[model samples]
Target: MGVVTSIIHKKINEEENTILFFGRILEYKGIDYLIKAEPLISEKIPNIKIIIAGSGDFSKYESMINHKNHFEIINEYIPDEKVSELFQKSSVVVLPYIEASQTGIIPIAYAFKKPVVATDVGSLSEVIVDGVTGFIVPPRDSKLLADSLLNILLNKNLKNSMGSAAYEFMKENMSWKGIAQKTIGEYQKLLGNFEKPRYLIGSLQ
Candidate 1:
């Protein structure tokens, strides 16, 4: 399916040194591991804030996180307008999924040019380019996850560069326009519209 291409990019909130986890809070989502990593990450980047924006039973791991003070848990459904706000405010977006088939968060983060720190599981590896658009760590490894997030948050230049690359990747490969063209190509092939396919390829060139 083609990604929704109607988003308008917002300027990054440069003043806030924030990391975000914006989605459902579930066991498979691995928010517990992310929370565990917060303290380790905070040790290196003391002032960095972690925003866990979603609705779920956060009390399950509330006592386990070492650096609870550094986190802001918005334990409710995030509204449409607020989605952009959260993405814009954060320096990095994290997906610490223990298991997943696919995720819509990466493309959404790409729209804001926000670099991601996701676990390597299922299709997440296909979406994230390690050391390029973002970093992918092994699932449930809080230390490695923290290190990857720290690497992005501590270095502003790297964050900005990766974010820019993320956006470019979205525009080039995942944009609805590109997806529509591919769909059209398939349809044309089925219909034996050879001349139109040539025209399409030529125009792209």
Candidate 2:
């Protein structure tokens, strides 16, 4: 993994300020708004690298980019073997989705101990504890998205704090043991009597 990671580092030109826009580049993923936020993000970070890694038709989005030099686009299906290397290389993960049902990206980012900056849509926000795990901005609002990215990129301490929290959140909340405990707690709290929830599981309404 280290050898491959080194190769990826070269591909990224060793840019640590890189924000990754990963996953399938579909319309609902809102790559357009990311292009719109390019200038705003560059005004502050300057040498920022926005790495778009995933399989999709990118010609349409290629023309929309302003600072063409600042982007590192890999418009192809990233293999599972390389996925860890890619995430480990990123400073932050971004999901500028305009529409979503749910996403598994948040947990994946957290697992890598990387902070995420995603837009509020569907169940995305429900996962991110804004300003704690990561920042959640309004969907389709490029400025807010850019601002959140800037916030994470500019402050190293804040970024580290958020990343650590993100990992912990996933470790504790998304795990089977944690989920079971939380679920039982919720049931107990709802009943206010520590009663068994056997009857509540559609056995008796």
Model 1, span 16-103: residue lDDT tens: 5798999988889998898888888878878978899998888887887676679888999887667877888888999999999999
Candidate 2 shows a clash count of 0
TM-score of 1: 0.84
With a 3 Å backbone cut-off (N, CA, C), the pairs that clash in candidate 2 are none
Model 1 residue runs over 4 Å out of place are 1-12, 184-205
The ten-residue window of minimal lDDT in model 2 covers: 1-10
Angstrom error of the Cα, residue 111, model 1: value is 0.4
TM-score against truth, every candidate: 0.84, 0.83
Candidate 2's TM-score: 0.83
Off by over 4 Å in 2: 1-15, 186-205
lDDT of 1 at 181: 80
How high is the CA lDDT of each candidate model?
A: 0.85, 0.85
Q: Provide the lDDT at 157 for model 2.
A: 94
